[model samples]
Target: MTGRELLRMVAAQVCVHGVMTGTRLAAPLLALQIGYSAAQVGVMLALFALSPVLLALSAGRLADKHGLRLPMHLAIGGATLGAGIAAIWPIFPVLCVSALLTGAAAATTQISMQRHVGRAAKNTSELKAVFSWMAIAPALGNFLGPLIAGVVIDHAGPEPAHEWGFRAAFAVLALMPLITLWLLRGAHEAPPEPSEEAPADRSVWDLLSVPQLRLLLLVNWMQSAAWDVHTFVVPILGHERGMSASTIGVLLGVFAAAAAAVRVVLPILSERVPEWGVVLVSTVVAACALVAYPLTPGAVSMGVCSAVLGVALGAVQPMIMSVLHQITPPNRQGEAMALRIMTLNFSSFLMPMLFGSLGAVLGVSGLFWLIGGLLVVGAPSVKGLRVDETPHERPGDPR
Candidate 1:
């Protein structure tokens, strides 16, 4: 893809994914405002990830077969409808449904987009650069979504109910996905390679037999759990500390902004930086930051911690994606990407509820330490990853 086309793809992703991210903030806060318990709110948050866990493999296979156009259309429609439902209803039950819709939509968009972009690269360097550029969508979406929702929630009205504020935020989120549809106008889909098709007898599980891919997924799960803990716990922690909606949003936004900032520079350094080294350092830093997160005393201190964690986690995806595209086969990349999404969302689906129940007993600080400790344990595995190796190549085989 040309730079302009690549940028358009990124913009499209930001719009669609932003709807999901924005709702993630707005819905949980609304439930909390309505006096739901953190555990209940956790259930609601878990719903966002639920559909993706079940549907990701199907979505990936769909992308592999149909390419971007069909999948993007489905994603745009689902996200728009999902947020619109919450905008109209604005209740806990409706919000759960919205979460399911938007989460699944975001996952579908990501698989299709990532597969498309990975295929566009001519070499490993381009793969790194392209994925780095694409990875910024989530960070930017995270920043924009929460910032918008938080500001609207804080200022939409003085109505004692705070109902209008949340409704307005959902309404705004509903419209954001339309921009993605517009940006995708006239986009081209590459013709499928006959050899790229997996046989009907093939199962997605076979991809896991590759040792490098398995290690990568394990490391990714650890990093993703850290992210889930931050996203799931921060609001509860901030709420317990009696911070305002805007303050919490800004804290989350700072993390995303830091993430986006790091990604902006990653493309420039893609040639110099080894993907494995970056992943290793990022994993270590993220572990440390998560451990330190709960100790921050106030918004400023928490924001500082958030930024540090953001930078560490933000640098991870491009490297992982680059290495992933290198190690996996060209034909089955979608299944591999889907498998990664399934694993992460499975954690996302469970971790919040797990965090909620655990948070009730151990407190949010303890939850942070738990994930951080796991990452520390997993850090050594990063040393084994090498992009030069592929799943198809047996040990000691001639190139």
Candidate 2:
């Protein structure tokens, strides 16, 4: 892809991501004001993730069979409508429906864009650069989304008024994705060429049977669980700590900024260290960060811990995407990306409810400790990514 096209794609992603992240944070807060318990909050978030988990593979197949543009358009429309629904009604049941729509739309839109970028790359170098660039967009969104929502919520002040604050936040964010359509106008990326030798009946299971791909997906799930827990738990933790809504948002933003800063130099970091090494270290750092997270006595300490956790978790995505693309069949790259999304959303779907229930009994600190322990248990999965087995390079080739 040309630099201009890449920039356009990233610009579009920033808006979509902002809505996704902003809504994610805002939704729970809204539900709490609506008088939902922590377990209820988990159920609400699970419903939000349901569509994405169910539809991810099909969305990928559609992108592969047709083109990226249609899916992108559909995604933007669905997300916009979903956000508008939440803004208009501001009820738990309606918010649940909104979550489903937004989740599916965001997953499809992201898969389409990822497929487009994967198709555009000419080699390993370009793939690394593009994926790294793409990573920064989410970092920006993660920061801006909640930051904006928190300020609005804080400004609204107190219960009933702050409820309107959330409604207004969703309404404002619903419009952001419209900018994506404008940015991507006239942007064209042809689908990947068909492979004549490939069998027509190849199934997802066949793809999953690959040891490395399977291992990558599993490790990805572990890391993704860590990411989800932080997003879900932080606001609750902040609220319990007597912090304001804006401080909670800033805490999440700090994590995102640290993540973005790491991605800014990821290409260079990947060159110096193998992908496996980076992932392994990330897992350890994430474990350590999670352990420290609940121990923070105040917001500054919590922010410091968030930055550390962000750095650890942030480094994993681009590396995993680059490696996953390298390992999968060229024509099935879209499918592989969908599978990744499925894994992520599936984790997003259930982990929150599970953790929230645990937090209700064990408290937020115990929830953090449990997540940290899980990360340590899952860290060995990263070792499965042998450098020699990675596609597109020699065993000792520097990434």
Best by TM-score: 1
lDDT of 1 by residue, 230-262 (tens): 888899899999999999989888887888899
User: What local distance difference test score does each model get?
Assistant: 0.86, 0.82
Candidate 2, residues 117-231, lDDT tens digits: the string is: 8778887767777888888886777678777777776676465348778888888889988999999888887655545134567688877777888899989988888888899
Worst 10 residues of 1 by lDDT: 390-399
Question: Candidate 2 overall Cα lDDT vs. reference?
Answer: 0.82
Model 2, clash count? 0
Highest lDDT model number: 1
Residue clash pairs of candidate 1: none
